[model samples]
Target: MHKTLSSKQLIINEALRLGFSDIGFSTVEHLAENEIHLKEWLDNGFHAGMSYMENHFEKRINPALLVEGSTTVVSVLLNYKPKLEQSDPEAPKLARYAYGKDYHFVIKDKLQLLFDYIKSDIYPDLEGRMFTDSAPVLDRAWAVNSGLGWIGKNTNLIHKKLGSFVLIGELIINMEIEPDTPIKEACGGCTRCIDACPTKALIGPYQLDSNKCISYLTIEHREEIPEEFKGKFENWAFGCDICQEACPWNWKARPTSENEFQPHPDLLQMTNDQWHNLDEDRFTELFRKSAVKRTKYKGLKRNLDFLKKK
Candidate 1:
């Protein structure tokens, strides 16, 4: 005779079969501690031009506001680690996450499928919505609250077994489920991420200064790259993975299993001179399905010019 599985266990099992690396649940409670951290990060102007961060003060901390009668937040970590990175040592480097198709679309599709499959169950009033790196959700906080992993010194969710290369998604539903115990910080006294930053972006243990972060200037900022960061970007033309690269937890990260997340051949094989002379046509053809499209043609040119100047 088979034992009856709880709703939470059934959900977790299904999420795994669907290819998520980790699935943990959190009660829909106010995140007071997280709110304070957000306030401090914003007050210090660490969020930079992203004013939207200040708009959803209440909704971010309280899932009750986002969904009615929300009791459980099913947080899932889908690995987006690319199968290949820029091969040429001197080729302007792209962030690992951007090497493949845009994760917002990839992960959101998976989340919706999970939602539909769960809805297929006989529960009459199973209400839920899937969220993946969009909206006002504080993904890292929710992932931590869901006991998926601890927020590392670089402010990324770091799993003991999977590292920080995971993409977080959530399914907030009205069903009751047992929540997992929160993971403790495994970073200890190690400051390799802090020490390895070329721009000193990590201002403190877990705090970062976005204005100085290479990832921010390259991808988030709208105007010219700040003169102060001129020589500090170290040729990174997109998001920075320096912190994660320095974290010891990454040693346990197996290469991603998702085919859609593999790097485009043209992107992976670009020579240094090719990247230096990359034009609109090649950029579009190569990154047509990747997250690098977020930067647009102009943004990529802007980043490339900045790298050239450096």
Candidate 2:
């Protein structure tokens, strides 16, 4: 006789079938512990110019606040590890995550399917909302609570199998499912990510000073790149991935199975001259659906010009 799978198992199996790297469940409650850390991070002005992190304080720590009557937080991971890198050794680099379509749309669509599966076949009355990096949700914290992975010293969620090259999404619903146990912190004295940071942005283990981070300086920062960060960008014209690249857990990271995450044909083939001569029209064509569009044409040119100075 076959053993019956619980509601949690059913959901997990369905999520995996939908091509998610992994899925886990957790109880919805006030994240009291995270509140302190978040407050301290905000108090230190670590959020930098992204003042929006200051908004929705209550909703960030509690899922139920975002979705009424929510009792379960279903966390899912989608691997974004690329199969290839830029072919030109001298060309400015882009963070692997920005190579493909914006993850917000990709993951949101998948989460809706998962949500529909839960309601139509299982719960039938599963009222909830899905979220990716959007909204005030503390994504990494919830992933940890759901036993998806532990937060690495670099502050990225690191699944033992999927590594850090993964994106997280969630479904907060009214139904309760058995929560998964949290995993152990596995960095274990690895300081490669800290030492690998060219701008000293890591500051200390598990601490990131975003004001000095290359990813933040290149993308989220709207103003001119600071002079102090000159030459520290290391040819990155978009986002930086030094910390994730330095993590040992990612050494064995396999390429993602999701074709939607694949880079455009010309993306990897772009040469230094092509990037340097890029115009607004070319930029639009190359990054038509990519996350790289976040930086915009002018912003990318700014980064490219900055790299030339080095």
Candidate 3:
């Protein structure tokens, strides 16, 4: 710590220059608000088979416990809005986030760059770690505290101006920074995200049934695709974007400026039938570096088979 807050603004400025669309800083505190919701969801088994969510209870709250003497959490949002969308209405779909390189690698590089820049320019002595969705860090809670955005009914960060198409990453540092004012809930009285859920996964405002969430089914759940959810996935083959598509904030959505976020040539030209018959070879060439690789070939084929099933 430099015994001042100037170093805090220094980190945020560097994050913006590095192409992060939004950045916010907050003092590390226990996840007081999110704890009850999480515990209840877990108790109800809403996590489905994501047993790991139940593994890190205390760590998911107090940042200081995870990182020795951690004082501040810095949250950054990189927009992942794709430059192109699936063209065919009948095409089996993929999430926009998976259109390019795996976000874990993509976001980690940017976060590490931020850390290195902080080490050289802001505080050479400061120690911290950066993680996107890859860590036990409470990224959404930190983002809300930092005022970057409000957690919408969909449980995703909803930016007032930037919308929900952003990718969140964090750097937890021992040094203090100028705290960002928390963003107010701009969701108003709108229930669009709740009402539009195909599986009725939205239990209420700001709540979701993760077991029924399409994204969870297609991405996180490793078991058989639930027969009940067969046609409810809409056209999404990998992950669902229906709530985002139904959001008003997305109306002014612009293409992300990050070139790494851009889609591959094979992905851009995919047709509905091509996706249906897609085999291992084409899968490797198109998605070798893509986030879709997280689900692996067999998982994707499972989803595809589920989609084509009568």
lDDT of 1 by residue, 231-300 (tens): 7877789998999999999966888898878888777889989987888898889999988998898998
Write the residue-wise lDDT of candidate 3 on 1-310 in tens digits.
4556677667778888888988998998888878888889889888887889898789998888888888889899989898777777788888888988888888888888999988888777889888888767878889999999899888889887779999999999987787889968888888898889999888898777789988888889999977888778887888888999889988797779988878887787788889878899999998989989888889899898888877
Clashes of each: 0, 0, 1
Task: Report the lDDT of model 3 for residue 126.
Answer: 83
| Root-mean-square deviation of every model | 1.9, 1.7, 1.5
Query: Which model scores highest in lDDT?
Result: 2
TM-score, cand. 1 vs. native: 0.96
Deviation of model 2 at 189, angstroms: 1.0
What local distance difference test score does each model get? 0.85, 0.91, 0.85
Cα RMSD of predicted structure 2: 1.7
List the candidates ranked by lDDT, beginning with the highest.
Answer: 2, 3, 1
Q: Write the per-residue lDDT of candidate 2 for residues 112-213, one digit (tens) a residue.
A: 999999888788878989999999999999999989899888889999998999999999889878778999899998899999999998888878889999
- State model 3's lDDT: 0.85
